[model samples]
Target: MTTHFWLNETRPARQAGAPENRVYVRQYGNGRAILLAVHGFGRSGARMERLGLQLGDQFTTLAPDLPYHGKTEWYDDRYTPREFSRILQQLLDRYPDRPVFLMGHSLGGRYLSSCLAGLEHPDLRDLVLVAPDGAGGRYTNWIDTLPSMLVRPLARISERPRSILRLSGWLSKRGIINRYSAEYLKSNLNDRPFRRRIAGTLRSVLKFPPRAEAFERALQRHAMVCTVFVGDRDPLLHHDRLQSIYGPLPSVALHHYSGSHWLPERLLGEYYRNSLLTTVP
Candidate 1:
C-alpha cells in the first residue's frame, strides 16, 4: 500500500471493528476540537483524507470508513442513516470535552442530514454537510435514472426476504445495475480501485431505504451550528426545496457552488475551490 493508502494514528491510537474490516484512519493538527469527516455512498475514509489534512491544520480530524465501506467488513444488517447517526453519537461519547464538528459528503452528507434532523448530542457544536441527502429529499426522490427507482424497492425487500439480498448483491457485482448507478459520482473518484470500493459500499446503502420518520425526529431533537453546501447545477436535488430547507436553520448557513455533487474531489487541490470549502460565514 502507498503512504496515503496506509492509516496513521496520533491521538487515541487506531483500531479496527473486525478482522476483515478495513477501518484505516489519519489524524492531523493540534486543536482540541474534532471534525469527523464522513464520505458519501460508495466512498471510503481515504477519499476524505485531503479534507482531513486541510482542515487538520486548524482542528483535530478523525476520518473513518463506514461499515462495509472502504476497508470495513460487509454485513447483512440494514445500514440506514439512523444507524450511522448512532455510530457517530458513540464516537462523540468516546472523546470528551472537545466539541464535535461533523462534515459529510454525498451519502455521507445524507447521513449528516439525518443526524442533524434527529441528533441530540449536546456536545455537537457544528455540522458542515456537503451535498447532503434528504435536504429536499433529493436522493429519495431522484428518479432520472432507472437504477435509482430499482434500488429503493430492492432495499425495501432486503429486510424480510433473505433471498433478495443475495440477488441484490449478485446484480450489483455483475456490473448490470452497478455501473449505471455510479454515473453521477465518477468524477470525484479518479482511481479505479477507489471507485470499486465506493461503488460497492453505495450498493449496500442503496439496498437499505432510509426511515423518514426516524430521520425527522432526529432533525427536531438536534440543534447544532450547521451549514449545507450544494452545487447549483446538480440535478439530484430540487432547488425549490433546497431553498425551503435553508430558511429555518437556527444556527445554520447555506452555500452554493458552481460544481456538481462531487464538489469536494473536483475542487480539491485547486486553490480557488479549496478556498470555497472554508469560505463560510
Candidate 2:
C-alpha cells in the first residue's frame, strides 16, 4: 500500500517530494491587464493565439496546454487544482496588482472551472466564455458511462478511436447521444494527434464532474464579472441552456449570437490566419 501527502503553508514543515510540471505557455499581446486563456479539448495553447490578437494588445494572454495537449507534460494521474494554480501562479506572482481576466472556449471552460474549484483569487476581474461546455445542457458525452473495471481499458481504446467511432455513431443514430457528441467524435477520431490528446486527458477529465455551482461560487467570491457567449444554433451548448445555468447569477451575463458549435474557430481562426499572412515578409 502507498500513501501520499501534500504540504501547504499552514501545515507543519516537513520534507516532501513535489512533482514538477512542465507547462508550455504561448504568450501573446503586451497589454496592461492579464488575460489567461484556455483552449478546448484536443487543442494546444496555440488554439487561443487568435483570440489574444482579437482582443488587441491590452492584455498579456497566457495560453497554456493542459495534459495530453501541446508541449505540456503531466505524469500524475490526477490534474489537481493546486497544479492548475501553480501553473498560472507565475503570472500572478509577477504582477501582483494587475487585474486578471480568464477566457475559455468549449471544453476549456469545464477544465478551467474544475481547476479553479480549489483556488481563491480576488484578482480575477472577469471571465469570458465562448460556447462553454459542462454547463448542464446538451454537452454530454456518451462514452462516459462504464464499469469501474473497464475504465482503464476504455481510456486505452480512446487512443486509437477508429475502432469505437462506429459505436459512437450507432449510439447517436439511436438518439442515445446528442448530435454534437457524434459529430465531435467522428471529426477528431481520425486524426492520431487528436486521438492522443483524447487518450491522455480522458481519464483525468472524466473525473471532473459537473461544477456549475462551484463556478458560480468562485465568481461571487471573487466579485468577478462573467460574460457568456453562446451560439444560437450550436448543437452542443445552445443559448437557452446556457441561460439556465448563468441566468440567475448576478455576476453573469449571457449573450447569444448567430452561429454553430464551431463559432470560435470560424471567426478567430480566419482573423488570426489573415493577421499572420499579412505580417509575413
Q: Which one wins on lDDT? A: 2
Give the alpha-carbon lDDT of every model.
Answer: 0.55, 0.65
User: Per-residue alpha-carbon lDDT of model 2 for 183-258, expressed as tens digits?
Assistant: 8888888887677666656566666555567778877777766777777787666456567777887777877778
For candidate 2, the per-residue lDDT at 247 reads 87
Clashes of 1: 10
Per-residue lDDT for 139 in model 1? 50
Residue 154 error, candidate 1, Å: 2.5
Model 1 regions more than 4 Å off: 1-26, 117-122, 136-140, 143-223, 248-251, 265-281
Model 2 alpha-carbon drift over 4 Å, by segment: 1-20, 76-78, 136-140, 143-152, 183-187, 238-240, 263-281
**lDDT of model 1, residue 64:** 67
Where does candidate 2 clash, by residue pair?
Answer: none
Best by TM-score: 2
Whole-model lDDT for model 1 versus the true structure? 0.55
